[model samples]
Target: INYYVITTFVFQSAIKLALFHTFWWMFSQNSHILFHEMMRKIKYARIAFGHVLFDDT
Candidate 1:
């Protein structure tokens, strides 16, 4: 009986850890993609603004 209880606890702990790691990894990847996209957009905007300012001057 004691052995069964221990096994059950271990199994639950492992599943919890795996789920947490998977969720964290996915969140980090998503954030990284968003950051890169935002950077690209900012760069494009900066170039466009510069062109407009130069044209007006």
Candidate 2:
């Protein structure tokens, strides 16, 4: 029933959605590079440790 409360809620939702969209766009643009860099780090770590030192557990 309060217009101020409704307006504030809508504004916050819009801001959150905009931020998420921007982040997704940026990530999509550099996803391949990010994946490649991550893999490279993992490869080097394995080589240095002589095995997979990190585990899921």
Candidate 3:
């Protein structure tokens, strides 16, 4: 009886862990893409600022 209970518990835990890992992976992927886009925008902003300053001079 204890063995059956333990097995059931383990199976449930495994399923939960798998779901959590999948969610974490998806969140990380989205954050990574957002970070890259932010970096690109910052790089473009810096270039624009430089051009504006130089053009003024």
**lDDT of candidate 1 at residue 53, scale 0 to 100:** 49
Residue-level error in angstroms, candidate 1, position 9? 0.1
Every candidate's lDDT: 0.60, 0.57, 0.60
Sort by TM-score, best first: what order?
A: 2, 1, 3
What is candidate 1's lDDT per residue for 1-57, written digit by digit as tens? Answer: 575576557656655665565566557778776566556655765665466446533
Give the range of the ten consecutive residues with the poorest summed lDDT in model 3. Answer: 48-57
The best candidate by TM-score is 2
Model 2 lDDT tens row, 1-57: 875586567656655665565566557768776666556655654463443233222
Instruction: Give residue 37's lDDT in candidate 2 (0 to 100).
Output: 54
Predicted candidate 3 versus true structure: per-residue lDDT over 1-57, tens digit per residue? 575576557656655665565566557778776566556655765675465446633
TM-score of 3: 0.47
- For candidate 1, the 10 contiguous residues with the lowest summed lDDT are 48-57
User: Candidate 2 — worst ten consecutive residues by lDDT sum?
Assistant: 48-57
